[model samples]
Target: MNYENKSFSIKSWAEDDRPREKLLLKGKSALSDAELIAILIGSGSRSESAVDLSKRILNSIDNNINKLGKLSVLDLQKFKGIGEAKAISIITAIELGRRRRLEGALELSKIASSQEVFNIMQPIIGELQHEEFWIIYLNNSNKVLLKEQSSKGGLTGTLVDVRLVFKKAIELFSTGIILCHNHPSGKLQPSNADKLITSKLKSAGDTLDIKVLDHLIITENAYFSFADENLM
Candidate 1:
């Protein structure tokens, strides 16, 4: 054992200061979101501290942890020294945290009203740069069955997969679903394609005994609910 060779590993912080060690000693409640992220990031670039980078990221979103998770991969790339691999690592970690949070609360049928949909969606919706379609499957009692991602796409937008959407409904034994997507354009108004696709999905739902409750278009600061305005 060459004792002199152990000087320059990434874990320069003392055991008390190490995020994981602190968590072990003090429990998870002792760690802030940035501290947790610093643990994930492991180390910083030459001049920046991992905690500082995490703080900068959090501050960019007005100190909202949930909001930062939704930031686009491209948007994250804007930070200096964050290359593609690091960007993916950051995005994937946030996504896993979200899914973990949703694991116990993904009851579809219990949720009602566009506001409920908005609340569940704000995290995923806020960070998107392009369009993404999510299907909120609800049981006969309107309790959430599951939240499944239907599709993702570019400026032209996601193509709704009617067959796959129904497949998930069948798996969850859902009686209804809510269609949700984001408008990167910041205009909550549904596009012509948006309208056309909604009509198609609604018609399909009718045939399959699955109801189409609403289609919500969320923006950076606003949202539109089809059911709220009787669009569906």
Candidate 2:
């Protein structure tokens, strides 16, 4: 075989420079994102090593892993040397990473106060451009049973049903519930609708023997707590 015709492979590279080898020697965290992707791809075209191709692929998406994770198999196959198998490998890895994140969040099952609730939710809903309503169910000890999104709507408003909220709390055997939502406009002040909903949910919770712990209005930079303000 002509030397020029030989495709580049990770095995031919120096041990420390090869993705798999480097991973073994320095540990997985020591590898770059492209190196990790290259290990997944396994091979590359005649002109490029897997690492080079992986770098090119990431660059195409501006190195944004979230955008790359959203790619379909067909979309990935548009790149050279990335066929059906490689595309599947990439997508499967991305999905696993996403699941791990959700699992980590679930592991943080206990919450103590409104500020703790804010810390947990700030990252999830703080950056959204629209309104979202969430209910967190807690046991008697304030251990979080589940966090559920109750409603999502446009920039101006979101509709949340009180019945659905209590139903979920009852199903979870929760003793307390925390209500939360975001104001995309970065206004922390609660609207009249906000006041009315807070009153309605609190009343319903009381009748059902479930305590309404707090209602928080969140924004990108600030938050308002109804309980802290003596409105609850």
Candidate 3:
């Protein structure tokens, strides 16, 4: 028997072992990360099963789903069994999950602390390779009105148009605004430019009676708050 070139199809597995059947019989939560991904890819190459291929892919990223989500289509297609379609399926699923999380975070009607701001903004810009500036517009009672991306830039920094920032704030009748931007470098410390921008926005907000409640420097895992540190 030439086992070297054999293909192990998912159908050969027992009902409980097949990723799709396992999900239908047990539950989605019952499936391992690789099993779920196996469902996405649907099939394997001549040398392995979909589950086996998924495991190998996950292992390449140390089994971190966040890292997996960051993989581009080209990046994923480099794997043995992952072609363009399978790679797209993985990317699309990851993106949908991210949007679901973002929607859940936005359900926070009222902003209470800097942590809440992070929860709302992290999904929008946290994992990016570039920088994005966002403003969280709030009513007098701290209830969120809107979150708008103010600008985008490269890995180093982004330009913020202070006039546009307050223009939307005024239009929304927002009494307060939270400034936020991501540091893709994952450094939580506010840089000199960060401080300067915060100062400029806070000064502008003061004139219009729109409070700059906090300015958050967001990263993938953590955040820094200007107000919390009395920098505001």
- TM-scores of the candidates are 0.59, 0.70, 0.94
Residues 1-232, candidate 2, lDDT per residue (tens digit)? Answer: 7988888988888899998989899999999999999999999989899999999999999998876876899999999999999999999998887667556656676876677777777666765789999998999999988888999999989999999999999999999999999998889999999999999999999999999999999875578999989999
Each prediction's RMSD over C-alphas, in Å, is: 6.5, 4.9, 1.5
For candidate 2, the TM-score is: 0.70
TM match of model 3 to true structure: 0.94
lDDT of 3 by residue, 20-98 (tens): 9999999899999999999999999888999999999999999999999999999999998889999999999999999
Q: 26-140, model 1: which lDDT tens digit per residue?
A: 9999998878877776766766767777788888889886677767779887876566777788889878877774454444437868887886886676457888999998888
In model 1, the runs with Cα more than 4 Å from the true position are 1-109
Please tell me which predicted candidate would have the highest TM-score against the true structure.
Answer: 3
Quantify all predictions' global Cα lDDT against the true fold. Answer: 0.81, 0.89, 0.94
Best by lDDT: 3
| lDDT computed for candidate 3 | 0.94
Off by over 4 Å in 2: 1-6, 113-134, 149-158, 170-173, 180-232
